[model samples]
Target: MSRALLIIDVQNDFTEGGALGVDGGAAVAAGVSRLLEAHPDAYDLVVASRDWHDADNDNGGHFAGEQAPDFVATWPEHCVAGTPGAEYHSDLATDAIDIHVQKGQGQPAYSIFEGTTPDGETLSQVLADRGITDIDVVGLATDYCVRASALDAIEHGQHVRVLTDLVAGVADESSASALAELAHAGADVVDSSVVAA
Candidate 1:
């Protein structure tokens, strides 16, 4: 089976010291890079996603303007397109990524499926065209984007594995819940060490 590595939103806005930074986000970025470096051919394709929201407006009410951010639905201004916050974390090696996806352009998007490549191809189309059947997911915010991406991958008929060690979350409880849910949904929630190169 042709396996693909899905890196979800390992951006500066998600890492430590970012707008919506998570505690271990930087570590996840570094760990993912190390994984890619050690297992250069573990997957046939590598795709990375970023939250490229609009800078001019609220991005379809995604950004909290006057109202205080609830942190669930509406969030603070972050990852604006072309901004440094929208850029990928430096620890993540982008040269290994074959497809770069930009999501949440003008709306709320969590799954990588909601994103599109520079040529405007959807994530599903990219995987389908490349005959990708298996996907190993790794990246930031285990409870949010990473969870959504892996769930979408399963729904799209792709076998998915989550590299737990290579992910960081906003909260411990929610992250644990998300992983349990993914495991129940048929995803293999394992550490990266088990993946064969």
Candidate 2:
């Protein structure tokens, strides 16, 4: 089984001091970087997802609206296209990334595989072309994009393992519940230590 690391949204906007920052997001990046360094050849492919949303888009409005639900409307504007916030966190090992998938180009694409690329190929197709079977997920808010990407990977018939230590969430309870849900879905929820081993 060829393994790949699917790093989800380890962007500046999701880190501390940025809009919609997750708790310990920066730490997640650092941990992921270390994991990648420790297991340089463990993965056949290394991919990263970025939340690249438009500045004046409906997705932005979804969070800014008055009638938006508490969970949905709570976050401030983040990851706007071409902004520094949309860029990957500085701590990540950029040289290790073999593929870069930019999501939320128009709307809020939670799943990295769902978004289309500039070359008209989806992330899943790109991975499929490379014959990637095992996917190790990491980064960003574990309750949202990370969870969505892992589930999507399972749906696409890829064995998924989430590096729990390399992920942070905006809400503790929700993140814990999401991890449980991922486990229930048959995805392995392991830590960086497990990856390092």
Candidate 3:
């Protein structure tokens, strides 16, 4: 069986200097790039994901409209489709990614499991098609997308690992909690150094 890497939501909107910027987002992007540079052939498949919310609608009540966002269920306007914020961060080595999955098109999608490729393939389909038995996850907002994606990967019956150094988060406390949850769910919480090809 082959192994795959899931790079989740390293978009400009989630990175530093963009809308809804999270701390260390830019660092995560750069670190992911460096990791790929150091071990380009480590995984058989490398899939990357992003938030591609539609610009017209409020994304199925995901974006708070004229009301204060709770920051849990509702959030500020970010990563709208066709916008620069939706694009991957400049520091990310997009060329190394094999597949691109876009989620939350006019909806609330946190997990990469909720996403599909341009060719309309679901994340699980891609994994199944590629015969992915082990999954390595990394990316932005560790407490949110990364957390959700890791959990879903486990649910999909794949041996999962989250590259601790390769992700950023919106908040520290929640991020720590999310990591604990992932570990409790049987995902290996490791550093990027452990991912050598």
Candidate 4:
């Protein structure tokens, strides 16, 4: 079975010192890079996603606007398209990525599955076209994007594994709960070390 690596939202805004930064986000970036460099052939396809929201508008109420951001359904303005914040973190080696996905163009998007490639192909379409049957998920904000992406991958009829060490989250409790939920949903929650190149 073909395997793919799904790197979710390892962007500047999600890393330390940016809007909605998560603790250990930068480490996840570096770790992911190392994984790809060390296992160049481990995955048939390497895909990375970023939050590319529209700067001119609230992105369909995704941004809190005049109201304070509740950090739940609404968030502060971040990762505007063409901005540095929307770019992937420097620590993540983008040269290794075969596909780059941009999500939340003008709406609230948490999963990479909600994104599209430069060619306008959906992630599911890309995977199906490539015959990718197994996926290894890793990246920032585990409780949000990583969690959602893995669940969607499972729902899409793909085998999924979440590399715990390669992800960071917004909070401790929520991240733990999200991991538990993923495990319950049939995703193998494990460390990147367990994966063989």
What is candidate 2's TM-score against the reference?
A: 0.92
Count of clashes in candidate 3? 0
CA RMSD, predictions in order: 0.8, 1.9, 0.9, 0.8
Q: 66-148, model 4: which lDDT tens digit per residue? A: 99999989999999999988889999999999999999999999999999999999999999999999999999789999999
Q: Candidate 3: give the clashing pairs.
A: none
Candidate 2, residues 64-183, lDDT tens digits: the string is: 545545665344567888999998999988888988888876665788887766776898888889999899999988999998999999999999999887889979999999999999
Q: Which ranges in model 3 have alpha carbons more than 4 Å from their true place? A: none
Better of 1 and 2 by lDDT: 1
Q: Candidate 3 local accuracy as lDDT?
A: 0.93
Going through the candidates in order, what is the number of backbone clashes in each? 0, 0, 0, 0
lDDT of 1: 0.94
Cα-lDDT of candidate 4: 0.94
Which pairs of residues collide in model 4?
none
lDDT of 4 at 3: 96
Q: TM-score of model 1 relative to the true fold?
A: 0.98
In model 1, the number of clashes is 0
- lDDT per model vs. reference: 0.94, 0.85, 0.93, 0.94
